[model samples]
Target: MSGLIALLDDVAAISKVAAASIDDVAGQAVKASAKAAGAVIDDAAVTPKYVNGFDASRELPIVMRIARGSIFNKVVILLPIALLLSAFAPWLISPLLMIGGAYLCFEGAEKVWHALNPGDGHDSEAHIQGEGGGVSLEESRVAGAVKTDFILSAEIMTIALSAIPVADPLWMKALILLVVAVLITAAVYGFVALVVKADDFGLGLARRGGGMAALGRGIVRFMPGFMKVLTIVGTAAMVWVGGNIVIHGMHELGMHQPYQWIKDTAAAAALAVPQVAGLVNWAVTAFFDGIFGIILGFILIPIATKVINPLIGALRGLFGKTEKAGH
Candidate 1:
């Protein structure tokens, strides 16, 4: 009887530890997700465009396919790479993160440049319209979107990985990353699904006579403006987050001029509004970081277009020929 009681006590203790570990994983996952908010918002904002012009019935299905591809990108591809880095090459994370950050900055700035200059072969209306191309177009769009998602997912995973404590056990780190991957994928794609389907939902309600009909009409009217707002917010977030990442990376590498200057400026701003000091500090910091991001992004655009892009294309061509020769 005494032995049985001791066994039960031991089991209970193990259960407690397991519960605690699960809690820790959940907490870290949420924290890491928040850290990647810019990428998350951009992912959600950008995904809807892929489904544009599709029939209402096809929109959800297309979203599902993209979501599946995103899941595969994050879990099957990125998670392993992230874990290996964490386990062996942790020092590389910050540099890789900065690269991702620069990409985000470039993307945001390019959008702004295009917006200001319009119709320089960058027309937004060029996306395939009228739903006539069928499965090939759908497949092509999904493939392209998935490819874009891979880059964003890389950023999300790297940011999440960086947010985690280095002293965490390997298994715990793995668990946290796994949770981050699943959570971010679900949240981003889930929002995309809703955004794409919202008009149809609103139309459905509009057909029914009641207060719901008015609400439905209101939703229909609201969607376009809401989409614009979402895009603006996503762009702003990308630059701010990207700038912050690069600044932090530079600080880590002991080049702290802009980071320190930005900090001092933010502190000065915060002093004027003690009641909302935290908000003021953050706003000031984001403002400067965004300015830095814009400058860096503009600098990178010409180099990326005139140099890096052509080089990448040539390398890809070379690799393709080599593979063909081997086969």
Candidate 2:
């Protein structure tokens, strides 16, 4: 009887420790996921456009496919790579993060430039109406979305990895990142599914003819403006997060002038309005970060479009020719 009681007590203690570990993992996952908000928001905002012209019935399926790809990207591809980096070349993380940040700034700045110069016609109606069969178009869109998701997923995983403590056990870090990956993927794609189907839901409601119908009609009317607002917010987030990353990376790399200047300016602003000092400081910091991001983005745009893009295209072309010749 004494032996059995001791065994039971041991089991109980083990269970308590397991439960506590699980709780800790969950808490850390949420905190780490929050750090990647910029990438997450951009993922959510950009995904809906992929399903925009698709058939209503296909929207959810398309989202599911992309979500699956995203999960694979995060778990099978990015997770292992992230772990290897954490274990070995940890110093590479900050530079890679800065590269990702620069990409974000370039993307956001390109959008802003396009918005200002709508005559560029890069995303004009004609581009959408290009000669392609519906199935092919769908495939192309899905592939494009998946490719974009891979970049955003890399950013998210890196940011999450960075947020984890260096002293954590490998298993704990893996568990925290895995949880973050699953939760973020579900949140982003789930929200995307809702956004894509909302119009259909609204249309159905509008057809029913009642108070519900009016509400449905209102939804239909609201979605366009809502999407525009979402895009603007996402772009702003990308710039802000990107700029912040680069600034911090610079500080880490021992060039502290920009970061110190921004800090001093924010501190000065905060002192001027001590009542809402924290809020003022954050806003001022974000504003300057966003401006820096915009400027960096603009600088990168021409290089990316003129040099990087052409080089990539040539490489792809050469690879395609090599495969053809081999066959």
Candidate 3:
């Protein structure tokens, strides 16, 4: 009857609304994910090293375990933290983001410093290769990688949360962040899995002994160089994104001098090259951002190495003593 028709119409309207909300979530998720590209690239670039020297059979399994841990870090740990920040302490987001940005800058600059002065012996490659005596090497590597991923995931989630519109409903923000978490974790770790196994794939192709074999040999030869390039790119991205975030955050906090100076300088550079003005502007901006990041990172290096590291070691020692006493 008429009443049945009205009920059906109401249901249809609700369905339409739900569909629109889902679409919004998807769109926002993709946009937010793109905002965290620097961290994503670094994640992909950093992960493969953890599986290095492992048997081919173990590579994929290791990656899967790391990926699972990354998901847990993002979903179970960071997601709720992000939601709580959005709901309660929205004002703190900018400062926390700047802190993360400073970290990126410091990391990138330290790498540059090490590259320029290779005798430092502080490289992670050496640490990763050095055998730890207590636990299985594989377990130690996995634990280290998961710890690293937690930091990167915190950066990713925070960046994504900042990218979402503040006016959006809480549920909408949650949905967008959830989607971003799942998609980004899958993408980074999946690419890492491929990178880790590429050598084996190349070897298999070489064994076939044909035209395809040549391609496989090429892949095998190309992988090391490609990884180096990826690392360099990831490092640069971290510097750029981190520096940019700090600058923007400062601007938001009413310290606009640096941001304005950069903008003006980039505009001048763009005007000098009218044919590729946009490209010129971006290049100039990125250049200055990188420089700023390097400087800030250099400043932080001594503090981190001398102060923060020792403090952390002391705390860990204290906790170990406490636990033993309790036992």
Candidate 4:
């Protein structure tokens, strides 16, 4: 009987330990996902464009396809690469991170460049409008979105990998990253599905419901504006996060002036706003980070378009394959 009691107590302890481990995994996953929120938001923002011209009935299907592709991208492809990097070439992590950061900077800056100049090539935009030949336009868009997701997912996994606590075993890190990969992909795509279907949902509610029908009508009216606002927010987030990564990467690589200036400037701005100091600090910091990103992005646009593009073209030309430009 005493032995039986001891066994029960041991089982209880094991159960407790298991529960704690699960809790720890969940907590770590949430924290790591937060670190990669920028990439996540960009992923969400970039996805909707893929289904833009498709029929409403096809929207969810396209999103699901993209989501499946995203899962394959993160879990099957990027996750292994990430783990291999962690194990074998941990030294490559920082450089790869910087490369992703620079790409983000370039993308954010290109948006600003377009807003400022407005007279760029239309061939790029034509793909979004479903103008490509032969293959179903939907397939092209899905392929393009999946390609874009690959870049953003690479960044997301890297950022999540960096946030992982080094004390944890490589297996633990892998588990956390797996959780993050599933969670972020679900979240970004889920939100995207909601965004793409908001109008339909609202219309259905407005038509089929009762007392809240007026509210549904209001929602139906407001969704367009909300989408636009979300787009702006997503863009700002991209710049802020991208700028931040590059700034922090520079610090990691031993350059500190830009980081110091951004910090001091944000601190001063916060000091000036005594009543909303916290909000002021956050706003100031984001503002400066975004501004820095915009400037860096603008500087890179010409280099990317003229030099990098041509160099890439030449390389591909030498290899007898045409290099495609990023959309």
Candidate 5:
């Protein structure tokens, strides 16, 4: 009897420990996901645009395809790479993050440029379609969205990896990141699904009469303006997060002038407004960071379009010819 009781007690203790570990992993995953919120917002905001011209029935399917690609990007591709980086090339994380950040800045700035100069023949989606216009367009959009997601997913995974403590065990780090990846992808895509189908949802509601009809009409009327606001917010987030990442990466690399300056300025602003110190600090920091991102993005635009893009195209052409010859 005594031996059985002891065995049961040991089992119970192990169960308790297991439960606690699960809770800790969940908590850490949530925190890590929160840290990657900027990227998450961008993901959500950018995805709906891909479904814009598609038939209403096809919208959900398209979003699902992109979401699946996003999961593959985060889980199959990025997760293992993130784990490997954590295990071996940890120092490479910051530079890679800065590269992702620069891309974000470029994307955000390009949008801004287009917004400012509407009709300026910017080659945004020219390569997305071919001879078979409709089918090719859809496939190309999905591919483009997936390609964009890969960069954002890389940033998110790296940010999550950085959020985990250095003292954590390898398995624990992997588990936490896995949780973060799954949870963030689900939340982002779920929200995107809702955003894209909201008009249809509203129309369904509008068909049903009474107060619901009014509400439905409001939703239908409101979505366009809401989408505009979401786009603007997403753009600002991209610039702010991108700039902040680069500045912090510079700090990590030991060149911390602007970062230190931003920190000091934010702190001073916080001190000036103690009641809303946190909000003030964040707003001030984001403002300067956005300014820096805009400047960097503008500087890179010409270089990227003229030099980097041409080089990439030439390389792709070379690979295409080589593969054809081999075939």
Candidate 6:
């Protein structure tokens, strides 16, 4: 009887340890995931556009495919690479983070510029139809969405990797990143699925009897505005997060003048606000971040459209032209 009791006690103790570890993992995952909020929001905002033109039947599948690709990007590829890099060349993390931050700022600023200009040339897609042959069209749309998801996933994973606690073992870091990746992919795509199907849900409600039907029509009516709101929110988030990342990265790199200046200015503003100093401080910091982001993005715009675009086009042509010649 004594031996059995001891054995049971030991089992209970192990279970408690296991439970604690699980909680630790979950905590770490949430923290890491939060760091990628900008990218995650962009993913949600950007995905709906891809399904815009497609038949209703195709939307969910397309989102699923992309979500799967995003999972693979984070888990199979980015996770391992992040683990290795963290374990070995941790110094490179800041520079790489800065690059990601710059990319986000450029993207966010570009969106703002486009909204202001409303130039006819900016490419934004919403719906994807299966090619005339429904099957091929389906395949193509799925592949395209997956490719786009991969890019966003890369950003998310990098952000999460940067967010992990540096003192943790590589295994712990890897576990945290993996948990974050799975949870984020599920949340993002699940929300996307809901967004994509919303119109159908509304229409179904509009048709059915009772208060629910009226609710459905309202949903349909509301979605267009809702999408517009989402776009604006996503754009703002991108700029704020991107700017903050870049500024912090600069400080980490020992290029502290701009960051220090911004902090001092924000502090001064915060001091002026006697009642809500914290709010003022946050506002001042964000304002400078956004300003810096705009400046950097403006600098990048011309370069992207001119040098980068042409170089990319030329490289594509170089490879494709040869392949064509060979064929």
TM-score of each: 0.95, 0.94, 0.94, 0.89, 0.94, 0.89
The 10-residue segment of model 3 with minimum total lDDT is 126-135
lDDT of each: 0.91, 0.91, 0.91, 0.83, 0.88, 0.83
Worst 10 residues of 2 by lDDT: 122-131
Residue ranges of candidate 1 with Cα displaced over 4 Å:
122-132, 320-327
Per-residue lDDT of 219 in model 2:
94
TM-score of 5: 0.94
Off by over 4 Å in 4: 122-126, 132-135, 205-213, 268-277, 321-327
lDDT of 2 by residue, 1-327 (tens): 999999999999999999999998998899999989989998998889888777898999999999999999999999999999999999999999999999889888988988999889554123333347588988887788888899999999999999999888899999999999999999999999999998999999999998799999999999999999999999999999999999999999999978999999999999999999999999999999999999999999889878998999999999999999999
Residues 227-308 of candidate 6: C-alpha lDDT, one tens digit per residue = 9999988887777777888899999888896899999998999888879999999888888887887778778877887898
- lDDT value, residue 276 of candidate 6: 93
For 121-169, candidate 1 gives per-residue lDDT tens digits of 7433244332447788898788878888999999999999999999999
RMSD of each: 2.0, 2.0, 1.9, 3.8, 1.8, 2.7
Candidate 6 residue pairs in clash (backbone atoms < 3 Å) = 49-126, 52-126, 52-127, 53-126, 53-127, 54-127, 54-128, 131-137
For each candidate, how many residue pairs have backbone atoms clashing (under 3 Å)?
Answer: 0, 0, 0, 0, 0, 8
Rate residue 289 of model 2 by lDDT.
Answer: 93
Model 1, CA-based lDDT: 0.91
lDDT of 2: 0.91
lDDT by residue (tens digit), candidate 5, 127-243: 433234467778988998899888889989998988889888888888999899889888988999899889998998999987899889989999999999998998898888888
